[model samples]
Target chain A: MSCWDTIADYGLRSLGIGERLLPRDNFTLCQQVTLIGSGMIWNVYFGTLAMVSGFFLATAVALGKAAQSPLLRKPSEWFIFVFRGSPLFIQFFFAYFLFLSLKQTHPIFEPFTAAWLGALIVLFLNTAAYSGEIFYGALQSIPKGDLEAADAYGFTGWNKFRRITWPTMLRLAWPAYTNEAIFLFHATALVFFSGFPAWQQRGDALYYASYFADKTFNPFIPYPILAGYFILLTLTVTGLFGLVNRRLNRHLPQQSRSKLRLRPNLLR
Target chain B: MLCYLTTGKHMAIYVSVLVVLVLLAITAVTALIFGFGGAMAARSRFLPLSWFGKGYIAIVRGVPDIAFFLFFVLALDIGFEMLRHGIKCPDWTAPIWQGNDFVVCPEAKLPLGNAPQWVHETYAFFLAVLTFSIVFGAFAANVLYGAMRAVPRAQLETAEAYGMTHRQTFWRVLVPQMWVYALPGLSNLWMVLIKATPLLFLLGIEDIVYWARELGGSKTPRFTDYPHGDWRMWYFLALLVFYLAFTRVSEIALDRIMRRLTHGQATLAGEAQRKAAT
Candidate 1:
């Protein structure tokens, strides 16, 4: 078939749309590209959803970790440690199995077995922990002067936190949090690799890329395609985060605003 | 069921833990070598070498490392086999790349067709180790390169005034001082390295993840006496706890080492130490 035919058929193939069966033999470059591009939809889906939800959860976790009460602090500390210390790959495996076992007992967990929900949950927790750590560090590092200013203005407790603490913590954490988000985005590739099956070959970008590599016995093409897609995805994430970062620093004068440069460090 | 635990295959699961540790140790050493070389090359006067080092560091920035892991293993395997094919099977002219298949002569096959199973496993393990080293080496190179630059320029100039050669100054003055600057970044890389070990399962090794899945799968009564429902959750939970404890211990140890390393250095920590000593 022509390239257009391949795109038409495999454009939404990863979502189980046009194509019922993947190209088994005589794989074309277009087929490889289209299928892998289709698969990236899942990566974008997982990364965006997890990050959007995880931001709020991570903030809550950071607050809990910094809370005065042991009741809140202890669990938050342990949650951060458990998620941060372990391999995310193992987390996915464990979560998938846990969901599977739960499915055996409860019908509500049936949807959780699917990669969209189950793997997303694992990614959610994993990013929350890493981002929570960043925010917690930022929380602790928030200048004492800022809190004192808030207290002098009669901004007590929740108001103090809302006005002074949360914004500053986020500003301090944004750079590192950007790194964590990118890391988590790259990590969505691990979902299919875990025990979580890519139902009906509807996997992520790496999945389609690996599939093509296996079928064609050529690693050069599909892997780079996947890498290129990921590169673009990471760039987009950095850009989006940079925008939020600017908003976070809007109150500061231009001379004082810390420039947001993407650092090459792994997740903090 | 008890006999299964005693068998070699089952025992291999526990052995795989050691395999991971061995992989970690070997990868750590090799990655340091690659990183050092990369840093040196990046700093070299030669343009090509500098470009190569820069490329090595930049390559990790955009791509998901799992892609590299998957790609390098197969590419390296084929590369080795292709070289052996050209050298060993000169007379055979059937194209190695015939459409979709990579059919190398039997003599060209790694470990030879009739070699023992352990050799094959060892070779695979070696490849996995190499791949891990290469990927992580780039990250380390990035860290070390920055650290090298972070060393005080005055110290290097002082070494030059003392009539030390460039190489001697680099070794004695620059390298020693760079560690203090590099420690935080390197420690972060080490944690990342520890977290990355589970990807070995993706490389198709019988690591802990492999064992967890194999043991946790539902075993029918017909298959074995130890029939059990799917218990992968529990097995993976054990693996999770093991990793958490390992990382926690590593964190504590690394923190202690940082204090020791920074005892009299010029960093903030060292300044704090000096004040406390006074």
Candidate 2:
């Protein structure tokens, strides 16, 4: 079959569209790339949803961690500790098994056994914990003068936080937080490897890459193709975050604004 | 619990914990060495070498590390076999890639085709260790490169004024001071390394994750003394707790070490220490 035929068939195969059975033999280069790229849809799905939801939880967690009340602060600290301390791989396994057990107790949780919801929840919590810590650090480092200026302006409580504190905390945290975002996207590769089963044959990019490698016994092609896709994906993540980062620092002078250095913590 | 826990495979599970620890220790030391070499290469005056070092460091940025893990295992295995094939079976060339089969002479097989199980296991473990070291070495190189630059410029200048050669200055003045700067990044990398240990299961090393899945599966009464329903959740929870505790201890230990390392340095921690002492 021609390359277009391959693309038409497996282009959206990961979403359970178009193609039903995966290529069994004579795996061509076009087939490998298309299948792996199709699998990337799941990667994007997991990363985007997790990041969107995790942001709010991370914000709450940061605020909770910074609270003076032990009731709020204690749980936040422990939550950050537990999630940050344990491996994401283990977290996926435990959550999968937990959901499995939970499904037995109630049929409502049946959806939780699937990779989309199950793995998404795991990624959400994992990124929240890590980003919460980053935001907590940023919150603490928000300049004393900024707060003083807010108080002088008669801003208090929610107004103070929204107008002064939250913005400054986010501005300070955005560079590192961008790194966390990239890291989370990279981490979505682990979903299939952990206990969560990919429903039917639909798996992520790495899954299809490995599948191709197994079939062709050529790690050279599929792995590099996967890496190439991820490089594009990473660039896309960094580029989008760069826009938000620019907005976050728009108030500061160009020289004073923080750049999104791909340094700091990444990769679990 | 005791009946199944002490069984042979389960006992191997206990031993696998040691395997994980051994992997950690070896990989850490080896990666640090690779990082040091890489950092030096990056700073070298030669352009190509510098580009190479920089590329090694940057390669980790975009890609998921698990991809690297998967790639290196097969790639390295194939690489070693090809090398062996070149040496041992020069005459036998049926095209190694004969439709998805990497055929090399029997002698080209790592640990040899007739080798014992332990030898094969050792070779596999070695490959896994090397893969971890190479991937993590790049991360360490990034950390160490920054640390090297963070050392005070005046300190290096002073060593020059004292008539020290470049090598001497780097060894005696720069390396010693860079540690304090590198400590935080290195400590973070260490925690990352600890968390990555579970990936050994993917490499087929029979590590703790392997044992957990093996022992946690429901076994009929015919299979063993104890038959239980799926206990994988408990097994995974226990593994999770082990990692959490390990990381917690490492964190506390690293914090203490940081204090000790920064005691006489010029950083903020050192300033705080001096004020407290006064």
Candidate 3:
């Protein structure tokens, strides 16, 4: 097939579009690049949805964790610990099974079995736990002077939190939050490899890369293409987060503000 | 069968846990060695060495580790076979990469083609360890670099004033103090390493996830012995519990160690300790 013909047939293969069958023999460089690049749509989908939803949930979780009462604090603490402690791969497996069992008993929940719900649920909880820890640390580290200033100005409870505590916590946590965001994006690649089967053979980038590797018995070409896509994704995420970090730290004097540092130590 | 759970699958699960522990230990040591070398190179007067170390850290950090895992496994496998081919069969002249097949002379296989199954398993396990080390080594290098920088400047100056050699001062003052600074980042990295153990399944090692799927899939009487509905979910739930407990225990232990490391240090934790004592 010509390069244009190959593109037309396989460009949307990952979405169960034009191509009925993947290239079997004579896998060309264009085929590998286009197919893997097409598969990247799933990666971006999982990462973006998970990060966006996980952000709000994580904020709530962090607030719960910082609560004064045991009723609120205890549950949040346990939630954070359970999700943070377990591997995301295992979480995917466990969640898949749980969803499967639930569907068996109640068919109405069958929608949860697909990646849209199953993988998203796991990624959501996992990122929340990780970001919760970061936010919790930031909450604790908020300057006593800031709280005192709020109190002196008669900023009470909800108002105090809204006007003072929340902004400060976000500012303090922003750098670490950026690290958590990048890792969450990377962790999304594990979704297909875990319990959630790639429905209709429509898999993610790594999945397609593995498919090509298995067929051609050559890992040299396909895997690097996948890696290149991910590196680009990682750079884009870093750039976007840097912009947010800049906005968060805008009020501070340049010398007093902290720069966002990429730390790869954050994991599921 | 219940008997398989008690004997076969049970043993496999436990063995997989040991596999994870072994991988953890090997990766930690290997990465530390790599990190130390990288750190020294980064601080070297030679610009090329410093650039190489910095570039290594940056490249690994930018890419997802799963990508590296996939790439290295194949690269290393090919590289190994080619080395063996060069040594064991110098006269042989068949192309190793013919279209799709990577056919080396039968004599050139690392775990010889005729070797027992366990040899093949061990080879896969070794590859998994190497992948983990290479990826985690970069993170370790970053942490160690920061820790090395964090060591107080005055101590090094005093050693220089006392006419101590650079190596002597580095060993006596810098190395000792660097640990206190390095401990926090290392502890965080340790947690990450623990969580990453599940990737072993992807590497084709029969870790817990493998057994979970194998033993949990629906079984019919014709398959072997026990027949049951799909119970893979329950098996995975058990795996989750196992990991959660493992990580919780590690967290508690690490917090205690951090406390010990921070005692009498100038950090905020030390101030808190002093206040509590008073």
The CAPRI-style docking tier of model 3 reads medium
> B-chain TM-score, every candidate?
0.95, 0.97, 0.93
Measured against the true structure, the TM-scores of the candidates, in listed sequence, are 0.96, 0.97, 0.93
- Minimum summed lDDT over a 10-residue window in model 1 chain B is located at B1-10
Candidate 3 segments whose C-alpha is farther than 4 A from its true place: A151-160, B1-5, B221-227, B263-278
Q: Scoring each candidate complex against the real one, what DockQ results?
A: 0.72, 0.70, 0.65
Summarize candidate 1's per-residue lDDT along B219-268 as a digit string, tens digits.
Answer: 89997776788888988999999999888898999899999988999888
- The predicted structure with the larger lDDT, 2 or 3, is 2
What TM-score number comes out for model 3?
0.93
Model 1 lDDT vs. the true structure? 0.89
lDDT of 2 at B243: 99
Candidate 3, residues B1-278, lDDT tens digits: the string is 55757755568878887888888889999988888888878877799999998987877765567777777888888889999999999998878888878889999987898999999999999998888888888888888988999988998999999999999998898888788889888888888888888888888899878988887888898965667889998888888898888888888999998888888887788899989999
Candidate closer to the true structure by DockQ (higher is better), 1 or 2: 1
Q: What DockQ score does model 2 reach against the true complex?
A: 0.70
Compare candidates 1 and 3 on DockQ and give the better one. Answer: 1
Query: Where in model 2 is the C-alpha error above 4 Å?
Result: none
Number of the predicted model whose lDDT against the real structure is largest = 2
